[model samples]
Target: TIPACNANYLPEGISEHCPIKVTFVEEGLNTNKLFQFCNVWAKHPLFIDKVQAAWVKLLMVLLKKELKVLNTQFFRNVVAEANDDRMALYLAQNKLQADPMNMTLQRRREGEILEVQKYIIYGRDVLTT
Candidate 1:
């Protein structure tokens, strides 16, 4: 059976002093039996919502982790995969341009070069009036 959930969490932007509690519970202990039982619940409508909610929660956690790793090449690959080369380049240029001022990330030499290259590429070099 799919586990039922009850939530009484307060709405966002209401209180700054209130503490929140989160809990996860698994009812049965038999691993093989539980797998079979969960399989049946997968086709149920109520269980589908629960499963999707859990998946969304999992994705949120994964996204948070990905955002934390700024210098990872895998993240750069993922960003490139999500956008075309031109768009990705534009985004990288914009980020690199602003990175020196953002307190969250320490500026790098490559970032400064990107900023200068973007300026030279797009700045007032030609006339089109």
Candidate 2:
């Protein structure tokens, strides 16, 4: 016999060593179950409306989760690129100071350094537009 379930709980098993009890499945790949609505419930006028409301709520929750993942990735990539550029310029400047005549460090023009700084300081705000 199937036990009662709510929004976040599902009955999994019962203890066999002593008094029989129901253990709910809190997490696992196959823990989520399907919605089972009896056809007889259609006789109620509010049944359809209730189902629609439930489905809409579920869709909203799923959409929010997806948006969170996308936002996290966007921030991660944007910030990582910005940090990389800043680190590159800083490292080159440090090396140039150590070896004042290094040709590679001298190749990094002042304009290029300014461009990198501008991108990190201002271009990162491009997401607002």
Candidate 3:
């Protein structure tokens, strides 16, 4: 569960105590803004110690959160079950499409494609493409 404090400066119990409804804020699409906020927060006096380290960890979490959001949104209409191999291939394809210059994505897609080819060669009906 996400901590309420991490979300806003609201008091510990205030969110539960408040009678008014709070509209949900979509945070994934505005990654640049979120990173800027995290950068500023990391620079604050209270968070200054090991701010760089904190930023690294925060950035990882931020990235994961956004990626998950995007994956859900993008695959919402697709009925394919996301098993390990399928997820790896899907992520590799997405990365390749998003940034063709990324060598890692290229390598990953190549590896997945090779695996699919091997599976078909071995008489396994596990892969369609």
Candidate 4:
């Protein structure tokens, strides 16, 4: 059966930060269950807020330590991909330069150049006027 929340009047400043209680009722079986899974209360409106708060707190604590636990492999992969892309662009440029009359090589070189540029600017948060 679908779980639902009953609107309970809460005191000011209490309900604002509190997660809504979700109750699941099984009809005919007369069984009731609180919706909680994976360390999160599914019925609460502030579930995501709580999780994000905990995450930020954990990140802050981690930042105080010397261990680089997060984004290490991700950054490494990005660097590796950038290096490979640069090498490919270099080879394409050389091939195009050597055979200037070849339209295919020229197109390939242009595509490689654009790809490299796109990769470099992939996640940059740039604001335009």
Query: Scored by CA lDDT, what does every candidate get?
Result: 0.48, 0.58, 0.57, 0.59
Error of 2 at 96 (Å): 0.5
The prediction achieving the highest TM-score against the true structure is 4
User: Model 2: per-residue lDDT, tens digit, 20-121?
Assistant: 345655454666689997898998999989999999999999997887688567756554555565556556665666786878666763434664556546
Candidate 4 lDDT over 1-129, as tens digits, reads 456445543211111243344455544565678866664475689988988999999998879453333435445545456556666766876676578799998788777766667654787412111
Q: Candidate 2 — which pairs collide?
A: none
The positional error of residue 76 in candidate 2, measured at the CA in angstroms, is: 6.9
- TM-score, cand. 2: 0.33
Against the true structure, candidate 4 reaches a TM-score of: 0.39
Compute each candidate's TM-score over C-alphas.
Answer: 0.26, 0.33, 0.32, 0.39
Model 3, span 1-129: residue lDDT tens: 652332333211101232333456655576554434555665678776676788899999999788768757895522233244555666677677679899987788878766545544667444332
Error of 4 at 92 (Å): 0.6
Ranking by lDDT: 4, 2, 3, 1
Worst 10 residues of 1 by lDDT: 10-19
lDDT of 1 by residue, 88-124 (tens): 3445445644665664333443443344344336653
- The clash count of every prediction, one per candidate, is 0, 0, 0, 1
